[model samples]
Structures are given as C-alpha cells and as structure tokens.
Target: MAAYESAIQSRVDCIEIDVSRSSDEVLFTLHGRQGFTTDIRKHKF
Candidate 1:
C-alpha cells in the first residue's frame, strides 16, 4: 500500500500492479512471476 501511496504522491499518470482475489474474499496485490499462473484461491494468505 505504501508503494501505491508513493506513486500517488509522486503524481504519476499511471501505475501498474498485479491484483488477485483470494477465496476468503480478500483483495490484495500479487507479486512474482509464479503469481501470474498460480491460483491464489488455493493458498492461504
């Protein structure tokens, strides 16, 4: 979240991020190469 805040503070036109929703219905950013294909719902945060 700090990174997002920093980007906003920096006045950047756009920011890129990876987002995923867990089975528990939680929303958060997903990082790493494996995250692209991995199903976060199967894993616990």
Candidate 2:
C-alpha cells in the first residue's frame, strides 16, 4: 500500500498499525483515508 511508503522510507524504530480482528479471524490494518474524516468501524473488515 502506498500509505506504507512514508513509514518505510522514514525507517521508524516502531510503527503502529491500528488493527481490529474480526470474528472470522481477519486482521484489518488501518490505512489513510480520502478527503473528510471516515469512520473505519462502519466496515466490519
């Protein structure tokens, strides 16, 4: 994902990714959004 480019380039010691594990055992890592603020919870991942 392009959003990861910044983190990769920066070489940060620790990068946190907001993750939500669904009941189906799927992990969702938070990525940037479009124009306005978005409620990522709206999607069950």
By lDDT, the best candidate is 1
Q: What's the true lDDT of residue 1 in model 1?
A: 72
Candidate 1, 1-45: lDDT as tens digits: 786788789998876788899999998895454546655458985
TM-score of each: 0.48, 0.45
**Cα shift from native, residue 9, model 1 (Å):** 0.4
After superposing candidate 2 on the true structure, give the runs of residues whose Cα lies further than 4 Å from its correct spot: 32-45
Per residue, candidate 2 scores C-alpha lDDT tens digits across 1-45 of: 666778688886655577889999998988757566565547785
